[model samples]
Target: MQVIKKLKDFRTLELLQKANELTLKNHSNEITLERAIFLSWWCEKGDCAFCYMSTQKPRISDPKKARRQINSILAEAELCRRMGWNIEFLSGGYGSFSTSEIKSISQDIFKITKQPVWLNIGITNDLEEYGEEISGITGAIEIANPELHDKICPSKSLEDITNMLEVAGDLGFKKAITIILGLGETPDDLEYLFNLINDLKIHRVTFYSLNPHKDTIFETQPQPASLYYAGVVAATRIMFPELEIVCGTWIDNLANIGPLIMSGANGLTKFPLFKMFGTRYGKRVEEEVYWSGRKLKGTFTDFNSLKNGADLGELNPFIKRYIDKCLNKKPLKE
Candidate 1:
């Protein structure tokens, strides 16, 4: 019902009202969503030209460093948990670690908290094998376009991602799928993706706007208008009412948020000023917070800032405003 093709004659007030109502329904409390970082040292073999880490490098410098990394991420997770966030997400470059590497990740975090942990590593060769040890792990498949999937990530094909979902879904693991809009994909791609997610019973869906990272082949490509993303989010939510949809990493600003929320994004990720509040180029919350303190505020360290930022209500608005802003988008004129 929130889906609209154009915003020319959009009615803003009504859109805001509906979006707020939906936000309250989905997220009853004012809490920040927990986020974790998984370091990806390299692109998988045959990585597309657009990937930031596509250069030749090992997935990780050493598995030994994983312990320190997990410790850092978990420390942040614990803080987020204490702050009332109900979710903990582990994000990083895919192809950076082996499946066995994730075993250690799961074990380390399990020692820290009982909160839900979502892994955002790209496609893998064998996720089903980890089912026995990774009962608590939530899986993510991050292929955006099937054609570009092969073009960009040849080592892992679209079929591979589909297979991962089928296997994970059948295994009864809570799953999440990511769709990065604007890779020269079409409406048909969206249809296929939505249908697959629906059938798989994926726990969540994340949509990322294609951002031109520095030095990548897509560096000069313009991000699609906010209206386009809002339409997709709205339609996706309508198609899967119960699925928790998220607007991730590349969302442009407070203004862009309104359209997406109205269109049906029930959940969102937040971070402070990436190239100013409303623009797309930015770092994740964990990275931003860590660097900000390490450089500017001598009194605070990563762990301390993690603990403190977790409790700060001001940090929650980036997410809240996104949905509120989406809700404020003028409704599509009938």
Candidate 2:
């Protein structure tokens, strides 16, 4: 309604700004981080036709090395816990790991800090495998774009994923479904998927933009326009007002984020790509946005840390320059 009428009246930027303001009013001013820790066999078998690791570049990381990485990420999680971040997430590639291996890793992470562990790995074959022991475990059925997903992740098709989602839902876990935009999906297809997830009572939704991955089949494919992406975000917001919407920065970057932020996006799939070390910005923006909003700070400072709210206004000066050069925008003067 509001979005549809406004769509015809205002330019893309104006619509986006209004959406951003509306979202900001409803969310907190603090940013949280979500981190990905790829376990062994991370990208070994099921490489997306668009991911760098999927190409002929190199084999997956060694199991021992992957463990070390997880330990390092856990240490960062400790830092986030001490700072009182909004939330922390740990997810990775496939369900290729043994049940014991997955459980042990989940337990170790649970021991370190009490941050919510949103599993973005492959769907497990058995729910009994992840029982009451793994209490903080949240289930995510990522990549629901059937045909495109088959092209990228052939092993896990739409039917296989749907079955897993049912299992996860029945196990009394918080279930999330992810849909990657820009795979040539029709508006009707997108709407159907969103409504289907909602009907199933799955309350969390994540949207990602499709970009070229080194060595993937669609490496030369162009990304969708940012304004178009914003409209999709807005539509999703209106349809599922209570759904936890997470937008990934790895794909959206800075240029398109303003619009998505306004489109009632409450969760951000944060990573080093956005300069946030390991936090996921969920339904919140950084207070430092008041400033120049340029450099990507790994962590967030307390809202009360600044003297006046105005003191937080100056953002990192280079943010706009980065967006212009990167993302789907025309380059500006250097």
Predicted candidate 2 versus true structure: per-residue lDDT over 81-120, tens digit per residue: 4434434345555534667866777766566555435566
In angstroms, give how far residue 312 of model 1 lies from its true place: 21
Best candidate according to lDDT: 2
Prediction 1 global C-alpha lDDT: 0.52
Supply the TM-score for candidate 2. Answer: 0.70
TM-score per candidate = 0.67, 0.70
Write down the lDDT of every candidate, Cα atoms only. Answer: 0.52, 0.53
* lDDT of candidate 1 over 79-170, digit per residue (tens): 44443343435655555567777766766555545643566666665666564435423443444456666666666566666677667767
